[model samples]
Target: MAELTTLARPYAKAVFDAAKDQDAIDLWDQALAFAAQVAANEQVKVILAKPGLAEQRKAQLLADCFEEQLPEALSNFLSILAENNRLALLPAISELFSLYRADLERTVKMQVSTAFEMTAEQQQKLIDALSRKLERKVELESSVDQSLIGGVVIRTGDLVIDASVRGKLAKMANAVGS
Candidate 1:
């Protein structure tokens, strides 16, 4: 939700800055992803909602949820979140942290869906084009969707290029119906 995003942004920025300074951006990204998954567990949700539970207990429960012990910096960050009663904001924090990391690294991830699998050459070409267009290094992930009928659909964040035959037919059908 918007409120959670607003609440999580500062924490994410703080994590990003800290990780960047330490040259541990990748490590922090992995840590946040794991923490976000832990915070999303149903049992954790129940515990986090318990008003009478102390902040330390909530933080401890979160730490215990992780498969392994958190690193010192991440543990300290989690403790701060617990102290602020913001342990529930981990998912939003992870999401915003990822965005900040991507921006810092000048990387953009894109998806290409088509009716048939693409050759490596074709995939590389798509990646090159997207890198040039977006002015960022592009990671192109390919998927086959028979329902696409033909051609492809490229999705990058909020932007979608619907070049698939299915998409074209749908547009034509809408035009004719109108």
Candidate 2:
């Protein structure tokens, strides 16, 4: 079997290209979300994997589920995946599509985990700081992790800034132990 990323890349690229051509990135985004939802449903997964089910029937099921809401291109893409028995790759395809969109938009998604919830002012401050550091627009997703004790941990793609109290304390403990 191919790796999930390998399986998803071509699908993502195809959707991205189609969306770019149509000037309907949002439409592709919606389709990817819907596809991911369908792929995640256990019943749908079972039906997709059923040995006796024909490809045409699977395509019909997908069409019936999404034909009204999805664009023709997206519907056709879904049907192609059904025909190819690759419906399970939808989640990864969605993720890859998001990455492609973010790249095109010059936006970065950052995850900021703090010991406590931050005020809007603080969140904006962090965003500003990240924008300066990364030199790009930052879209932050914030969460509270009480285990941090205090301070924030920022994760942007391959970079992670661990400024949490727990991390500092661990470093100090290691220094003392040494």
Candidate with the greatest TM-score versus the true structure? 1
- Candidate 1 lDDT, tens digit per residue, 1-178? 9999999999999999999999999999988898899888898889898999999888887888678777889889989999999999999999999999889889988889999999999998988888888899998888999999999999977899999999999999999999
Candidate 1 stretches with Cα past 4 Å from truth are 66-69
Number of backbone-clashing residue pairs for each candidate, in the order shown: 0, 0
The TM-scores of all predictions, comma-separated, are 0.90, 0.89
- For candidate 2, give the lDDT of residue 30: 76
Error of 2 at 159 (Å): 2.9
Give the Å shift of residue 34 in candidate 2: 1.0
Worst 10 residues of 1 by lDDT: 61-70
lDDT of 1 at 40: 89
TM-score of 2: 0.89
Residue 178 accuracy (lDDT) in model 2: 100
